[model samples]
Target: MNRIEQLLPEEIEKRSFEIISEELDHMGVILPEDEAMITKRVIHTSADFEYTKTLTFSKDAVAIAKELIVNGADIVTDTNMAFSGINKKALSRFGGEVHCYMADETVAKLAKERGCTRATVSMEMASEIEKPVIFAIGNAPTALIQLYNMMQTKQWKPAFVIGVPVGFVNVEAAKELIMETELPYIVNRGRKGGSNIAAAICNALIYELTRNHQ
Candidate 1:
């Protein structure tokens, strides 16, 4: 087998990260520790280097996210794709758990009753978790909207929000709403994201924490 073919997926990913970082440097992108973590993962997800320029973050995004993970916080994803993409073992080392309630019957019923998207209602349900919560939204703008509304109400706030839903619907508007809030967030500006992007971002944070702690 060829060298590339012989390499395991994790090895290929590691080597790819090295290449991606080198390319970002050539393009004059000097990212901070946390920003690099998110940017690289997003690029890893979409293979779109443009994300290096498009992804935005709150001042304390990574720090706050790491803190939440270290505290065994629960991660809530907007879709099962994101939920399945996270590094559960790494998160579990810090007592964190990943959750996705999009398929729940109650969420469906609530969304229908409230005239809102199921993703939005799911966030309301996720907000009830007693421990710190991290929201990884990758499939629905409505979820981001709901979270932003909660941020306004002071009724619920997550340790961090990764809003990278991919679509042409209310995706852009929902992300814009999130930016207006004071919550720590890592958002892909524009409508180029999805559950994979969201999951990659979450894994990036978890991986970084695992690396830094080691």
Candidate 2:
């Protein structure tokens, strides 16, 4: 077995990023600046380099997301885990907040009455919010489908979307549907994302914004 090297508590993350960058370089995987930042963060979170290929971005998606974040865009997530994982304090600096309506009693009741998943109702509730919204979906394809449906009817428009739901059922289809739109989005092309990834992507963007502000 290889001996573990001594590392200070704070050095771990910095060293991890250094390793991620070196590996990406060794693989000849060069991403554009902002996209690279997001990609590296995703890879760091999952320790999966496959994200270099599986991650997709709409044109200027990262830039647009940054702009929205600077303007105080609120984020709506499909899962509480994702909601909890985001850097709330960092986002709050820009007057933004993270929301996960999946646990709301009203959402649950409405979903049962309408025979839809809580994700669907949660999205519906999110559409009613007046602020600029960014969606980070990591667990449910239904939420993406519902958002697409709402977009079709002109009932809702998100400033940006991170559509990375992980599953075999309808996950790929939902991601494809979102890609068909002109909306800005960061998505994983396959069933290879999770709530952790979604939160990581959000934090990545927020961290970038923090750097720009500083």
Candidate 3:
């Protein structure tokens, strides 16, 4: 019989946290509640404990993100997958909504014409919105690059940025670029990230606000 089969589902999860926590304790891991929550969830998703180190939170990123989310900041995603994964119903409680421009024809055309990625064009589009946006980029390095450049050039900033694009190429470089900036961000330090990480962190923040406060 499997070891997990011998336990209840809740027990299994409880044991898992206990194990992860014990492991972190051995490593002397200490973090604020909000950062720890997001890190734990990421570890839960990937089953990789390295996330405890790989996860980087700009000073007070979760707190800032919560304030933006609670104030109804618009969230712009790099992919529809990230867009779909966000807890929109919960976000809407604060008058916030999610957006993805990858499917927009105008963005596509501009991307093709400018020899840039569709995500790059989409970010340019996001800049036009009147409300401050929270950028959640997960799958494209170009998206992070464009957004970072735009912020520097235009001095326009998002309410917060989540940079966790996975894979090689410019992924690590893009994340590094974001780190150099003073923009508030939560970034997966290496190439180990994706749309799910981005969505999960956003949801974690939402859950933190609605559940932790209540």
How far in Å is the alpha carbon of 147 misplaced in model 3? 1.2
Question: Model 2 misses residue 58 by how many Å?
Answer: 0.5
- Per-prediction TM-score: 0.92, 0.98, 0.90
Q: After superposition, how far is residue 109 of candidate 3 from its true place, in Å?
A: 1.5
Q: TM-score of predicted model 1?
A: 0.92
RMSD of each: 1.9, 1.1, 2.1
Candidate 2 residues 137-181, lDDT tens each?
Answer: 999999999999999999888778899999999999999999999
lDDT of 1 by residue, 132-156 (tens): 8889999999889888888888988
Checking candidate 3 for backbone clashes, the offending pairs are none
Best by lDDT: 2
Error of 2 at 42 (Å): 0.2
lDDT (Cα atoms) of all candidates against the true structure? 0.87, 0.95, 0.88
Off by over 4 Å in 2: none
By TM-score: ranked, best first? 2, 1, 3
lDDT of 2: 0.95
Residue 36, model 1: lDDT of: 81
List runs of model 1 lying over 4 Å from the truth: 1-10
The CA-based lDDT of model 3 is what?
Answer: 0.88
Question: Candidate 1: minimum summed lDDT over ten consecutive residues — where?
Answer: 1-10
